[model samples]
Target: MRKSKSFSARTLDANALKSFAHPLRLRIYELLDERGPATATGLAALLGENTGATSYHLRELARHGMIEVAAGMGRGKEKYWRVVPGGFTYGDAPPDAEAASALEVLLDDLVRQRGSELARWREGASRAPAEWVEASGFGRRSLRLTVEETAELRDQVLEVLERYRTVADGRQAEAAEEGRDPSTGHVVIHFDVLPLGAVPEDEAAGQEADPAGQEAGPA
Candidate 1:
């Protein structure tokens, strides 16, 4: 949320995609994004990995510009790393077979991670504060829309999120200058929008026959 002039949006090329596709590297990036700057030793402890491995992956991520040394945060001879401020996307499908495989791995891992996070939240929700428990949950809706309409809806949602991000940044800066509140805590927001139930005919044919003997098609 802390926008800086140094931050720039990135679309991962094949090389960068391959570099970032490793499970450990992806997890390390997530940790940095969620928990702020950390040292290799600290990350290793959390990840149950050796410092050597974490250090190597950290360097790899840095090489791809996914992360950087957190300024003024580490003592001499030690370094802290954090995710770069701007976000990144996978971009178009990679032509290289290896890179394409890496992209699949990355996407699968991300979907699994999201499910795990939601499950964790549900398990702990009962023990959380009453207000938070009341305020937090998931919602889903099936909507009919054209491609352009779907894109417009996605953009509007992103704009709203950006507004909140700016507000959060301002509050964080104020807290840093003054004093932090004990009641403040981190919140993770997830947003996803995509066409549903659109399967290729060949893929659908390969699936088991429906009970009603109907062909599978778009919902």
Candidate 2:
């Protein structure tokens, strides 16, 4: 299993990857992760989709072990579904050609969605709560490190995030038991680490020519 800050997820095999590569299925999974448990009807309304379609996709997701029935939500004939605790991942590489192509499409869609969310947030950030505006924003850094060092840095960051995740889970449970809203905002955390390829010789020479460094571009 591959472990991230918030959860542990097993890498997906070819069959499971193929099953989960649909756009609607991906959106459904994202909703469950972000909004917590919900019924097919609820999800349908949120997505502007018909209940029948949502129900079918939900079942397919569940069949692939992507989601399951929420424990105590919904009544007879209405079932609530949720993302399975500890999600699944697309492994670094899929051996099957078809699966690899599917993974590419899935990843492209995910990146597009994330870009949209960030763009939306930026457009409305000024009107959001002052505290939220102050606390939320993007961050990035470029570092020179060996492969082992990169792995260590990732593990350390995950450890710190895991601690806060535990606290957040406890607080959520307490709020549920008390039958009161937590008044907590849902926050999304995005983390990524990747190698920047070696600079081209011409670019390297250009950089050396300007010792003062070029201004960074917008993120």
Candidate 3:
């Protein structure tokens, strides 16, 4: 499996999210998210769909700039597709409407992806590198920190995740070289950096400081 590029959740534009509303589209994006690039035929096998079906979905994704043909992978008929890496920073639809439903689909894809990644990790656990195997786990804890401090902690967590994320793909080949892992099963280690706050549920609810002061609290 290819290493996934970690995204800091961003507002996904309605157009972008809508483009991905199709089940096949979500599957294609998720496949690329976990397995890196592949041709239509290869993706079909992985998705249990016909090559034409996969090809059409991939083309749709390519049209939306969700996936791009990897450069220099090979010559003819070996196009590769990849997910665009960034937090969703474009969706402006209301939370309880049609577009919101679309956004939910995208979010569901993300949650499903975490499940797929976990399953793949377990299946390959024994065949993976000791360091990779050792570096894996699901962790959680309550934390006490000011809002800004919590934001800082989140950024720090993302930074560390970025540093380790390079190990999966060669985007940061130098970092990959520094963290030597014995060659073994191809893996993208999942690290859930969930920082649960210790604040009261009501206080946490009041922590809604949307950029525009619209105050959209967590429901």
Candidate 4:
């Protein structure tokens, strides 16, 4: 059985990327996922968009399975919207040209979002609680490992994050049952795992030997 308190994710294929590449749809999904649920009107106000535009995008997102009809009614008894239980994962580079284009759009949006978040934190962190300021950080480290070892390390890191989320979700549920608000505001964590240095010696030699469109290239 799937873990109730932890998140689940689906890997997006080429076709799925087509429907999820829109800017408004991406923003709507993020808002719904982060902040429980909201009506199109409410989302429009929060996003500074018109209600009609928000409603249209919401419908599109629902059609793509990114959002669903949330419980409770809104103004005019219209349905509220919330994100699906799990999120999506896609590779930076997909084989299909269309999918790659969509991934590019998403990555560009993510870059802007990350910059905005960092700016907000930098401007406000000093005045915030000492504990929070101390806990928040950014760092980089270099590690040398074989491909299999690298994959193992990545899995371990993901497992650790899932465990923490599970614990937090359980506590939130308990707080809700006790009739107390459990929210402590939103916190976003970003992880980057990328190769930064030169290619492996064997691969480099292979490429040098065949500098044409013949032999298979290093992935």
- Highest-TM-score candidate: 1
lDDT tens per residue, model 3, 34-142: 5666788888888899998998888887776677776656468677666655423433455646678877766556666777777777787899768876877766667
Q: 1-219, model 4: which lDDT tens digit per residue?
A: 111222355566677687788877888887876776688999999999999999999988887777788644355668788666545566547888888898877777777777777888889998988877887898677998777776666667767767766665554445434533544655777666655454688886886788784643212
Q: After superposition, how far is residue 94 of candidate 1 from its true place, in Å?
A: 2.3
State residue 37's C-alpha deviation in candidate 4, in Å: 1.4
List the candidates' TM-scores in order. 0.80, 0.78, 0.64, 0.74
Worst 10 residues of 4 by lDDT: 1-10
List clashing residue pairs in candidate 4.
none
The whole-model lDDT of each prediction reads 0.77, 0.76, 0.63, 0.71
Show the colliding residue pairs in model 1: none
By TM-score, the candidates rank as: 1, 2, 4, 3
| lDDT for residue 134 in candidate 4, whole number 0-100 | 81
lDDT of 2 by residue, 62-181 (tens): 988888886556678789887665445676768799998888777777677678788889898989999989889799989999888887887887777667766666655554346426
Task: Return whichever of 1 and 2 wins on TM-score.
Answer: 1
Candidate 4's TM-score? 0.74
Measured with C-alpha atoms, the lDDT of residue 63 in candidate 2 is: 86
Q: Stretches of candidate 1 above 4 Å error?
A: 1-8, 166-183, 201-219
Q: Can you tell me which runs of candidate 2 are displaced by over 4 Å?
A: 1-7, 167-181, 198-219
